[model samples]
Target: MRSFVRAGYNLRKKTGKWELKVRPDKDSMLGRGLLSEKEYHDPVRVFRKAFKEYRPEQFLEFLAEAVHFSLGPFNHAPEGNLIGPYLHLVKMIDAAWLIVERASAEK
Candidate 1:
């Protein structure tokens, strides 16, 4: 049987705490009340939903992919909605990195 996994990443903060960060697409959906906050807030739920397990390196890969796809094809529109999602993605990346670094030190 083929098993599909929804891969996600977590970053460790200086305070010795692990913070899980989800993709902006997933985060926005959860923030907008479209997806259950439980999914984002609960690690177990996130792991189960993502289907595939992920490590720090994999999480970094995901962030890089999102950044690569976002910083291109300049928009001439007046509103910044086009790039707003990318901005949020950047923040998520930072958070994930922080979590990873913190967790590594703890181990």
Candidate 2:
């Protein structure tokens, strides 16, 4: 299936804690709020709803906030509205794993 939002982990600059960074992929149609029904369902509506109820930054903020930190930059937005590399760390699996685990456990 096609991905809507790309999610990953990042450091909250001020608090110096790791946080999720979710962003719309540059080539994704979801980022533009242009998903076709035939392409997918729930995801289409999910992103559609997100784009309608939340501004792109609000999505970004939700994706980054500690409250929703597990959401991550990897799959930042359900609708694919958020985007970022936040950082350029190539070898991030170790850190990413820890963050994802914590976020999942919190949920």
The lDDT values for all models are: 0.39, 0.34
lDDT of 1 by residue, 4-82 (tens): 1112322121221353444544346524332245433432343333323334444445555555557886445333232
Q: After superposition, how far is residue 71 of candidate 1 from its true place, in Å?
A: 11
Q: Give each model a TM-score.
A: 0.31, 0.24
lDDT of 2 by residue, 8-61 (tens): 211312232323244324434433233333212222233333344544455345
- Top-lDDT structure, candidate number: 1
Candidate 1, residue 46: the lDDT equals: 34
Candidate 2 lDDT: 0.34
- Which portions of model 1 miss their true places by more than 4 Å? 1-80
